[model samples]
Target chain A: MKMHNFNSGPSILPQEVLNQAAEAVLNFNNIGLSLLEIGHRTSWFQDVLDESRSLIKELMQLGEEHEALYLHGGATTQFMQVPMNLLDDGETAAYCDNGIWGSKAIKEAKLFGNVNVVASSKDKNHTYINKGFEIPATSKYLHYTTNNTVEGTQWHALPETNVPLVADMSSDIFSRNMPFAKHSLIYAGAQKNMGAAGVTLVVVKKDVLGKIKRAIPPIMDYRIHIENGSLLNTPPVFAVYVSLLTLRWIKKEGGLAEMEKRAKERAEYLYNALDSLPLFVPTVNKEDRSFMNAVFVMQRPELEQPFLDECKKNGMVGVKGHRSVGGLRVSMYNAMPMDSVKAFVELMTEFNNKNL
Target chain B: MKMHNFNSGPSILPQEVLNQAAEAVLNFNNIGLSLLEIGHRTSWFQDVLDESRSLIKELMQLGEEHEALYLHGGATTQFMQVPMNLLDDGETAAYCDNGIWGSKAIKEAKLFGNVNVVASSKDKNHTYINKGFEIPATSKYLHYTTNNTVEGTQWHALPETNVPLVADMSSDIFSRNMPFAKHSLIYAGAQKNMGAAGVTLVVVKKDVLGKIKRAIPPIMDYRIHIENGSLLNTPPVFAVYVSLLTLRWIKKEGGLAEMEKRAKERAEYLYNALDSLPLFVPTVNKEDRSFMNAVFVMQRPELEQPFLDECKKNGMVGVKGHRSVGGLRVSMYNAMPMDSVKAFVELMTEFNNKNL
Candidate 1:
């Protein structure tokens, strides 16, 4: 059986990237040393660092005002560090509580300053992005999740706000064209549409920082990272190297425009199947449907087991839904080929035909 | 010429471990997916996580009273998070300002609570550990760096303090035996003597946490990590897997005792040559020398460039001194072979005969 991997985050990467990364691990750039063995300070690894940072700027078309930092600790750490560096005591920031990560980020933000729940999807089982509320002019920044990995919802268009924007594009970064100029900061954990876990990419507009009065911990300070060029400490070298290889793959495959096209095609095919199939139904609002993850459930709840069994029989892995939103979720990241999505739809169709 | 890697970290890894890790990057545990692709929650990776945690406990002889967590982020993150979880506001903790990392940790700890600098090596440019100072009885914990990476000094014996002891063992962990019950907590970045960069090994006595009154951020909370088995969020899977492979290598090569023996053997060989060879002098106090990193300076400043050139010609990399300490440093990590050190000594001997 041909396995179709859909493990969110620590998920699929381009085959070429995998092969190249594997080779580097054995002998980095033919230096007769494993990439794992080389120090980040070495010329071989410095090239990787410089290249990874530069590629992000090129892909997003970011300018001199923006600096890209490849940091360790994943996006989870960023939830706190972002506010720690940006939000001062008695200051206010607004956030949308649309999903698990969003709610968690809101919690961390409150620890630093007053965080306004400007919008929320909690009333609707987190199936939609809450866009009904207003962003306060006094808010230091308005934070939003560009894509919710668990809820299968994405903000196709960001809110037009005067307040500085900070977006966590963890699950959908590099999968589509980003309005790089609109946001003050865009951060992502390098797992979806990037590389492996352990690294976070924080692209920040330089001017938005240093206004807060708090003395930020040097490790967590974005300004220090911009000053030090993200070599604050020995970074997640293997993860960053893998990310660089992934960026190379993305550029080779026609960059974010092509990625967006493929992602849309995959989601459309899978989402259409979910709606039309006898025993299956799409879970989220169609307008807010995510290109990264398509979550659905069996209309006839009894068929859920058969659907899962059929998926397993076909070697479809990680299609299992998050425990919070139980049913099914198929992550179609940038690296997920159209053929894999087609195979997934076929499995769903066959399972529905037998069970319905 | 075969290269000799002595980079402090993100440094040399076991060759067999490197080969295995590289193979895993392509296909993990025969599951047709890259280790980079698998979800940390899946049984495949759950096994890796369980095995990694178990190996640490087994090697350290830790029992149920202690729990080991494999976390994302490097040791620098640990500098702040350690105090965030351990020290409450106004509660004092004792720390030794022994080196750069130590000074950094002290700075972060002070942000969370009152930090007493009970001892320091700064007066001597961090070449020696100040042993005469006493830990305050009211201090919640006593923290120290096990090795001064910048200055090439090691604490051969941990300070016997009535206060709870916590160690930052980033550079020397897994290379020798640890006093499992003597410390309240032990943490290490996995880049040295373990694996690649990005993962942190936090071994904590279960009871030591939760004593503080302040609400520690969930991500920074040691108790939460213990409760969730360090899966509070996505972990650095590749780094952790590599760590497991390295641990396996360590066990195969006779574990900590063998590592300690090899380290002694390498240090003795290099230190002997440093003393006997012309135009070279050891920089640090002989009593405080680190078995892992040896720092030495040219007796004659004019010979520095010629010596460095000779080293490069013989394929010695990362032997140049840190800019902060303008002297050569040879990091003889556990993965470093005795043969490499022998080769380095030969290069030194020949260079001295030709120049000095």
Candidate 2:
């Protein structure tokens, strides 16, 4: 049976990417060495490093002004590293806490400096983005998550802020093209829309680094990684290789514009199915619904199991929502095909008819 | 041509392990979904986590007294984390700086507490371990790297310390059995002998945590990860899975005792080949020669290129030594077959005859 993957992260990747990644792991760049075992310093691996970084720059359409670094420790590590590198000890950074990831970032940032919660959707259980709050002029930077994977809310537009913007696009990166110049720094863990789970991609304005006064640990220092070309130590080689493959796939599939169109079509189909059905209710506010993840609850609680079972029988996987949200979440990442979404929607309609 | 991989880390893995890992990435544990796209909270992933952790405990022969935690940020992060969790700001920790990794650990340790260098092999350009050194009885813990990957040295026996001992066994972990009980903490980056590059394996005595005066970051706090079952954040899921496969392979091929015997045999074969040849000279002290990585250099500089080319033609890869030590290093890690070692030895003999 053909499986439609809908897990939040370590999510779906294009088949071409997977095949290329597998081939490289078997024999990298025709080097007769597994990508897993090649020395990070070798020209073969360096090509991977350079190409992966270049692809991100190309995808974002960022020029020499932005530097892309493939760093370890995932997005969670960046939560602390961002403030440690950008904010002085007593300075303040603005954070828009739209969901769990945003709140976590704020928490880590507070370890290094004072965090001004410019806006928070926590009062409304993070079901929508709060747009009315003011950004402080004194803030060093403003941090926000582009998409909340758990809650299924996405920022369709950039937040208006005079301060330098830092976006954690972990769940929605590459799903669409955005105004890259609005953000001074953007980071994303590759598992969601990129490739694997271990590596975090960061695009920082080269001028913004080395401003903080703290003696940041070498691993936590962006300057160190960038200077060494992200090969200061042995990198997550396999993850980076897979990410490169995914990037190539994205380019072959007509880049982010086409990706956004396909993503929207998939998400709209699923959302429309939920809206028209009597047995399900969409969780997020209509205006704030995520194209990356569609969250919905069963109208009748008892029908939840049968609906999930029917989806599974139809070869849909990872439809179960995050434990915090307790419903169904269809993570339609960039690599998730329109056919998979149509299949899922068909299953949902069938289950709704039976249950209703 | 079959390539013999001798890269110190991101080293070679068993062919079967690679095949199995690739299969899992496509469809994990018979689930029709790609392992990459599976939800970690699902029973399927949880089972992988539990079994992987369990295998580590079993392979190490670690009893109920010890706890294992799989973490991110590699062993480098543990350098700071060890002191942050165990020593107060003003307290001192004893460190044995035998090579690069040990000195790095000492450097990171100084960030959290005062470090007393009990012994250092640096006086001899890190070519030999200092047999004579006194551990400070007043120090919080004694730290050392069990194997120096760069210098190609290994501790034949651990130093007897009154204080708690910590070992950075990144390069030699799981290659052989050692005194697990002798140390309060043992941390290893998983790339070398264990699995991939992103995950770090930490085995800490249960009683050693939560004594520091400083507020450690949640991710940096060893106790927090331990208490949370290393699920403090989403882990390097695929890396852990690969480690589990390697562990299973080790168990199936007879335990660590057999592994030690095989490693010794392989190292001896390669070392004998280098020693007997007039063209090559071993780099490390004979008594301290590493069983995992055998470092050597050409007796005459001009013979280096031809010898390296001949070895490359024989399908040996990554035998070129580290830049710090300009020579050749044949890292005979656990997965290296004795036949490959013999093949390398043959190449060495042919090159030696030509050079002489």
Candidate 3:
């Protein structure tokens, strides 16, 4: 059965990318060596890194002042690295406590320097994006999670700030067109919209670094990584290659414009269906809802498990919500087909009608 | 033609492991989704992490005191993480400077604490591992690289020390039977003898951690990783899965005892052939020579390029040495076949005859 995959992260990748990745593992470019066996410094893998970095910049339409790096350790590592490199001890950085990822980033930043949470939606269970927050001019940077995967909220507009914006666009990067160059630093874990779980994509403006007074560890320092071209050490080669394939796919499919179109189509259909169905209630403010992940609950809480079981029987998987707060979360990444969204809606309609 | 792989880290893995890895990427366990598309928290992936951890402890024959963690970033990350977790500010730690990896380790450790350079083989270009290095009793830990991949020297015996032992076994881990319980922590990048390139295997004794006074980042802290069972954040899912497959292959083929046996056989054959060939010169001391990577150079340096060209024409690849030091290095990890060694020796003989 060709099931509809809705896993939050390590989520859906284009079918062609998966095919090429599998073939590369067996015989990389017919060189008779597994992709896993090749050295990172070799020309073959270097081409991969080069193309990936180039594609990232080209897609974002960023210039030479900004650099793209495919680094090991996920976005969680960046949570600390961002502070260590840009914010020195006694310096303050502004953060928005939107949800889990935002809160975690603030916590890690606090360890390295003073963090002032300028805005928070915590009082509302992070169901909506906090706007009109005052940005402190003394802050070295203003940090926020552009998309909250758990809370099912996304910032549709870039937060207006001149404090050198740093955004964790882990769940929404490359899925829609945005003012990418406006931010000084943008990082996203590859598993969600970019590629796989091992590699992280970081685009940073070179001028923002090296101003901190603290001595940063070489591995944790962004300037050192950029100087070495993200090859300061052995990177996740397979992950980067997969990401390159994905970047190529995005280019072929007409770039971010096409991706955003598909995202809107999917989100509108699901949201429209949820609004019509009396048995279901969509979580989060409608305007602040995420285009990638849709979180919802049943009016009759007892029907939740049965509805999930039915969805499973009908070839739906990974529709279950996050364990931290469970209801139902249907993640529709860039690769998710509209047909799957339609099928899920049909299933929801049938279940709601039968239950009512 | 099937090339004989000798690339230094990100080296060859078993043929069967590659096949299985490729298959999983297409359809993991017939789950109708690519392994790259599933969430790391899924039971499917949790099982992989669990088995890999169990296999690591079982192979090392360690007790409950030690915990095995599969982490992101390679051994280079550990160079600083080891010191950050173990050594406090102004505290002294003993380190041996044998070759590239050890020297890098020493450089990173200096940022975290006072480092005591107990032994160095720099006078001889790291051709031999230093023995009888005086480890300070008051030091927080004694750190060393067990195998110098670039210099082709390996420590056959553990250093005698009362301080906790931290070993970077990135090149030689799982290829030999060591006193595993004696070391406070053992970390290896899974590119050589373990599995692939992205994930690192960290086996740490629980007792040595949490004693340091500095505030450690959650991602860099060993205790946090172990407590979360290496699921502190989304790990390199595909990398860990490949490692699990490789670990299973190792166990199925008779564990570390059999791996060591094969390694010794392959090393001895290549080393003996190098010793006999009048045109070739083995670089390292006979006793300190690494069983994993054998570095050598042509007596007539000009013939080196011709020999390498001949090797390439005859289905040999990655025989080139490290870029830092220009000489040939043949890396024979656990998965390297005895047949490859025999063929390489035969080629060396043919090249010597032609050149002489």
Candidate 4:
């Protein structure tokens, strides 16, 4: 049975990437040594680290001013590190709480400094993207989760901010064309669209660092990591290499433009099916719906389990929504084929006919 | 040509573990999805995480009072996290400076609280472990590196301390039987003897946490991670899985008792050969010489490159020493085979005969 993996994170990667990674594990580049055994400082693995960073810059179309780093501890670690490095004890940072991830990010930032939640859609159950948030001129930075993975909202437009922009683009990064240059710091966990689960991709402009007064630990400091070329300590070697393979695939398959086209195509197909079916209810404001993850529920909530069971019988994985949101979530990341989305919609159509 | 890998950390893993890891990457346990694609929250991965943690506790002979965690950011991250979670502001903690890793750990600990350098081998170029250093009763913990990777030193016996013992056992954990219950906390990066690079293994006594007065970030908080079962966020899924497989192998091969026997046999075989050869001189105090990494230098430094080149030509990898200490280093971790060490010693004997 061909399993359609909609896992959301540690999610579906390109088939070729999986094959290459597996081959490398056994014998890396015909070096007679497994990739698992290779030293990170050696040229064999250095090439991997170097190419991964370079590819991120190339894919984002960013310039030399922005540096890319592959760090461990994921985006969750970044929640505290971002504030620890950027926000001082007395200084304030603007934050937008649109969903679970956004709220969590805001909560972490508050520990290091004053966090001004300029916008929040929590009152409405985070179904929409809040706009026209006022950013204080004295704000150190405007922090936002560009794409809400749980609530399924994505910021299509760059926020108007004079201060440095720190965006957690964990879910929607590289899935679409964006004004990436406008942001001072852009971070994404690799599990979704990028690669695997162990590494986080951080793109930071050099000038934004060294502004804080508090002593930030070297491991948590962005300047130290960038200065060391993300080799301050032993990094997640295999994860970064898999990410490199993923980035290479992204480039070979026509870059973000093609990715964006495919993302829109898949999301539109699934969303159209969801909207057309009376048995399924697509949540979240339509305008702010995520291109990566589509959240929907059945008209009869009891039918949700039956539909998910139907999905499981037909080899659909991770169709069940996150625990916080008890509905179905069909994640259409960059690697998700349009054919898979079509099959899922067809399943939905059949389920809807029987339930209705 | 079969290359003998001896890179210090990110060293060799059991061949069967590598094969299994590669297989899992393609299709995990005959599931329709790649191991890389499976969600961590799913039962498929929960078993991996649970078994890995349980195996660590069982191997360490730890009871229910202790908890095992698989975290990201490597052992380097633990350098800061240990103090952040255990040492409070204005308090003091004891640290032993054995070598590079120990020095780094001391440096990070200072940021959190006053560090009392109970002992240091820096005066002697970190060639031997320091002894008889008084640890303060007021100290939060007595931190030391159980086995120094660089400069080739290992503490054969635990230091006498009333303070809770915190150990950075990155190089030698699971390699030898120790007073496992005596230590309050132990951490090792998985790259060395465990599995791959990415996840770190941390074993902590539950009672030691919540003693610090400082506001620890939730991400850096051990209690939070323990409470969440190391699933506070997305862990390095594949890395943890590999570690699990490696742990399973360790148990199947008679656990730490068998590992220690193999380690001693390989080390003694190589050390005996080095002693017999007049051309190559082993450094470090004989009493404190590490079983994991054997550091040596050529009698004539000029012949070092030629010897290295010769070894390279004959399929030897990572024979060059760390750049900080300019000499040759042969690492024999838990997974290192006696046959490979014997081959290396034979090569050394041949080189000595040709030169001297």
Q: Model 1, residue B241: what's the lDDT?
A: 91
The fnat score for candidate 3 comes to: 0.88
Q: Model 4 segments beyond 4 Å from truth?
A: none
TM-score for each model = 0.98, 0.98, 0.99, 0.99
Best by DockQ: 4
For candidate 4, what is the lDDT? 0.91
Candidate 3 clash total?
Answer: 0
Error of 4 at B219 (Å): 0.8
TM-score of chain A of each: 0.98, 0.98, 0.99, 0.99
Cα error, residue B33 of model 4, in Å, equals 0.6
Worst 10 residues of 1 chain B by lDDT: B174-183
Model 1 alpha-carbon miss at residue B9, Å: 1.0
Taken in order, the candidates have interface RMSDs of 1.3, 1.4, 0.8, 0.7
Instruction: Give the higher-TM-score candidate: 2 or 4.
Output: 4
Model 2: colliding residue pairs: A10-B36
Clash list (residue pairs), candidate 4: none
Best of the candidates, lDDT:
3
